[model samples]
Target: MADSIFKRYLEKKNNLIKNRGILQATYVPDVLLHRDYQIEEIVDIVAPSLNKDKPSNIIIIGQTGTGKTAVVNYVGHELERADAENKNCRYIYVNCEVIDTPYSILYNISNQIITDPNKKIPFTGWSLEKIFNELANYIDDENKIFIVVLDEIDMSFKKNGDDIFYYLTTINEMLKNSRVSIIGITNNSTFAEKFLSPRIRSRLGEEKIVFPPYTPEQLIDILKNRAEQAFYPNVLDNSVIPYCAAISAQGSGDARKALDLLRISADIAERNGDSIVTSAHVDYARQKIELDAVVEVIKTLTDQSKIVLMSIIKTPSSNDTGSVTTGEVYTTYVELSKNLGYNPLSQRMVANLISEMDMLGIITARVKSFGRGGRTKEIDVNKVSNDVFSILSSDDIFRGMNLNQKLKKQTTLM
Candidate 1:
């Protein structure tokens, strides 16, 4: 019998990564560097729960990858440990991004507190009011202080409106034996002011803590800590960690991005059978990460927004730089929408969609004054990759459409 093809691949040893999970964004380490102040503040607020008192509802605000979730997770773990003897406290964490709707959010919390299989809430079919009542009753029955952490709280608010917030913030009024304190973690600092009413805002934002982005130095310390645990000694070049940190700091100071860069760089090196990960590997990882992020964002765009983006892509530039005016994009959009047998949106709507894409980094829209022509946005697609074109073409609406021919048609019209 022939040797199995997998045998050779399986025989290859992993020299770089000692423990891969340590490098992941989800891994909560024994120690979190550079977040002592934030951790202490959260600890102070939740300390009252140890004595069977309801702690203040907290709003933890920070940009992505600034360690908001990690700090909260760390504090919850510590809080659980301190209350291990009393058994009067319980910590429940629900990621609002996943369990988004009020029904699912309430259902998730109820199940966590209610241990009996027969007593647990069903996944669906119940009205929001019934689910809230059931969750409230279950928690009150347990008679324990529940500190619920709602991570990415703004996502749920944006999707389902403020009803969930109103229910959760006012839940305490409905409970008697048990007390529920909410700790909302959000990337948007203005989430409270923008989407929430004054009453809901006051209750939910009882206390707010903002986490600032990490500096390059702080990022380096974070990378060093993770690198020691993630990679074998001497497997990473001295310059690799600093390169990843510098690149991430230049963008959003996102430690998660820095960690991802390091992890992917090492993986790339290992795949190539290289002994040491280098700056070149980090560069390749950066490009791969950026392309993946852009593609994912493009995938989630609304169908109308996708068509508007396609219109921008097909529209011929007035100059050699491959940039088109918003008016040109709208013209192409009208034609494309008609070709696909879809109703064309107003020019104003198409222009707004273009601006949204620009904000998402898929395209660049710059304002240019044509004097008597007034002001207009000059759209550029230099940042978009071939992969994006493939994704757009794969859509059922755009499958049979001749995008190139449409481009030529727009050129002829111009």
Candidate 2:
């Protein structure tokens, strides 16, 4: 079956991509475009790790896809190569968003440094204190400099609490010979003041790097540099790169989103058997990329959040209003939870969750004047592809919702 499917795919013509991986945001290039200054500062900050000395704990804050993580990864790669002596130095990169808990983060760091499997802590069941002690012991025994990079560090604090941050920042004090230094990355540039407590803020204040969004011109340069390696010569039209960059710049100036647009455009071109990628391919790719993003975000929401979102989607707005009030959403949520065999949360708690969902860009919650003398917060789901309903509704909890009933319940939300 694999051979037959692959043979058919291989026989297809009009393959536009020379190397699709190059267009992915995850792919780190030896030379990062338009981020030289930030890279220089990062290199200076982390250079001491190569000498088996603890580098300063760094907080890199920026808008999404401004090359914060990429720069850290790039610096880590170079720092490792600089350690030609293999002086028992270690460079560990863990996305805190993935490994959120203090226990799991410590266990992972311990696992990376411990050469003997018998000495490693298991994934669960160990007390966080035990893991921290053992991890510190390993670092002390190994006499290594652990240069740890935690991407999306802000999200970790929000979800799992900053107790982990407190531990990571202070782990070095317990070690006599070995040291651990953090290079934390966050999307919120104001995370230090807004999200972090005073004590936590003090620990992470050792060094700070702010990554600004790319300008349209700078984004175009980045796209072109990546495109040379991502696509075959003459396989992409001249307008494709500019179009993707402009669109991305108008939004968040997100390099990742731009790259995604380019990658998906090439895919659509290849799938449609086109000789070269054009503006039309870019247009369709943008639509697909947006839809995929919405689907992914929906998939990540917790069951309760998903149910809350469903309630909002199902609650029809009255009086030709564009959106329903929080009260209307909670009433509908109560109905949704009961139908799904779950107890409903308090209205106040649901209102708070609604605000969180608003912050997530999943829904637009806003306060506006309702009448000459009244005001209330209104909420409506974001405009997403119709296919998103199917994706969200396919979840086991949502799966039982009859399609006809769903259509009948569909609110005029965008």
Candidate 3:
């Protein structure tokens, strides 16, 4: 008498993870905790839309996982109650991180609003301008209010431009009846402050809400609420939520990270044949989560950026200062690019990537000066070099490169 593979797998899985999806960042609980003021404020901002009037545009500024997206989604859908004329008001959400291009953003919105598959603009055939025109036409025809929530909206500006935003803000003038307004959610408010032109900034900044990082106690409450729903009874120890909450709060009160830590610790505990998630499980889960995040960032990097990172990793760590100079990194980057038969980016662009990667916490970089003459950044690979090396080595362009061998190989050949 042998058990089937499926039977064994199910039995093991059922030991934990009663509902894995509940723990995901995307899982929007019916109610959010400790955000009633934000909820009421957001509702009040978009309230005019209930009467078919254009609502005030909003820029929701918050550190990651303070419930920015959940609040808007909850409020947007609730606000979509039909008007007196039976106009079908809508809440359309777009993750600018995914739909980062102008053409793609317009196409997604067009497809969502256009009911007829045939009448919908061909995904490829329409010029971006014509697509924009057609998108505006379709929405105007609906004569309904549309509230668009652009999450990670900063990414859209970086990848594309402010053109789509400009159009959204001004599109109402083109419409005879319908109104389209945007609620932008972003992790970096400074991007808006620095990058957006004054005209666009003022338009979107009409009303702004900033969600501060959750206090440790707030995170504990949030994790506790989510854990109750995500795990079966007695699955988590009383201290588990508090520990995860404290760790996450230390890193800017990221509730999403808290949820992830909690969920992953449960999985780790379950895999270890433990019935209850414990604090040690949380520590192990934190390491895995952090490494996974860096791996993801590395994977999404452009080939040039990957090589740029590889250059920094391959540069010999300074014994005296423990960091490489920008010049040293650039030299390594150029050599590696030429080694792989790819033209290297200009030193300026490589420097820019260094700054970007530094911001991503991949490296530590600070400017140093040669008195009265010049300056360059002193760059040190953070402890995540192992994770970075692993991810880059897996990619085709970066294959066959090893930090230990890279310096030796280039030294011998050059």
Candidate 4:
């Protein structure tokens, strides 16, 4: 029976191919044509001080998907290969988003320096000062030049302030000859400047690299470069690559988003049993990405935001009305707060909460031009009712809520 089926299948003209999207990272070429300006700046910083024993630090500011992380990784790999000849030089990278807080971040660096796995530091329950002192000693003992890359430093600072900055910068002053350098990556340039004290800001001011968003044409080149390796011959529609590039370029010239769009469009094509990805597949993929982003935003929201959203969901005309006024949303918010047995705050506070929700893409607000006589803003429920309901029901905090009943009411209200 297997032989007969194999024979029948072989008789059919087949064009199935392994997807190129699976090899995403490999497909990303090492060339930095569009990012040459940034590469040149970073190289200058590293080159001048490579032979010197004094510690150096660099602060890199770039929006997401402008190849900040990629360029750093690429340069890091090259540095690693060069340093293999001399064991005294070392490079390590940590995404502060993953190792958030001063203690955790310091502990990670300490672990890299000290080879003892059994003496690993705990995530919490230790003072930041103790961790820093211990980590500084560990680095000193290594007697090697260390380069540390801290990606998403903004998130780290937001969680734990400038304490880590103080530790890293001050450690170099205390050490005798052991060199330490930090490559700090952040999406917000103003965040560090505004929050950090002048002392720490001046230390970080030595090397500043700002990366602007990519233009549509530049992004097209990036997409085309990756497409040649990711897909089989003629497997993608001619328009799909440019469409994905244009969409991503508009957002921030984010290469990651562009790559993701291409990957997702190919998956969509395969799901529909199509031989190649078309414009329709790319459009569908965009909708899917939007929904996924919204879902992820919903998942990370605080309990208070969920309560406010649930209140919006309870309203009968929210979907049709586009947005409920701030006052109306406040009323519903109070009702839900009561039902959940939590004390409700004032409308001003609720408005702030609504703004946070809007930032998270849970909802959108429209500012009405009310001829100097009306409210400045109105709240809009931008997401689909079902999507919001699905996300809320998945949360551990909202686990026991009546999802079906609430969603039923919302659907009826539609």
Instruction: Tell me the tens digit of each residue's lDDT in model 1 across 294-390.
Output: 7789888998999998887777777977788999989989988888888999988888888898899988899999979888899876664455666
Query: Which candidate achieves the best lDDT against the true structure?
Result: 1
Show the colliding residue pairs in model 4. 20-230
Candidate 2 lDDT by residue in tens digits, 1-414: 357757767799646788877987668776778888999998898777777777888888889988888888888888787885777567899988888777777887788888887877897999888888888888898888888888888878888888888998898889999888888889987787887888988787689888889998989999999888877799889899999999999857899988988999899889888899998998998877666677788888889988888787777777464578888888889988998999999988898888887887767888868668776678855452246566777888877577445443333221
Off by over 4 Å in 2: 1-10, 50-53, 86-88, 296-414
Each prediction's RMSD to truth? 4.5, 4.8, 5.9, 5.1
TM-score of 2: 0.78
Error (Å) of candidate 4 at residue 414 is 17
Best model per TM-score: 1
Error of 3 at 301 (Å): 8.1
> Could you tell me the lDDT of residue 259 within candidate 2?
91
Off by over 4 Å in 1: 301-353, 371-377, 390-414
Question: What is the lDDT ranking, best to worst?
Answer: 1, 3, 2, 4
Q: Regarding TM-score, does 1 or 4 come out ahead?
A: 1
lDDT of each: 0.87, 0.81, 0.83, 0.75
Number of residue pairs clashing in candidate 4, backbone atoms closer than 3 angstroms, sequence gap of 3 or more or interchain: 1
- Residue 261 displacement (Å), model 1: 1.4
Alpha-carbon error at 408 in model 3, in Å? 18
> Which runs in model 4 stand beyond 4 Å of their true positions?
1-29, 49-55, 116-134, 300-356, 367-386, 389-414
Cα-based TM-score, every candidate: 0.85, 0.78, 0.77, 0.79
The candidate, 2 or 3, that scores higher on TM-score is: 2
Ranking by TM-score: 1, 4, 2, 3
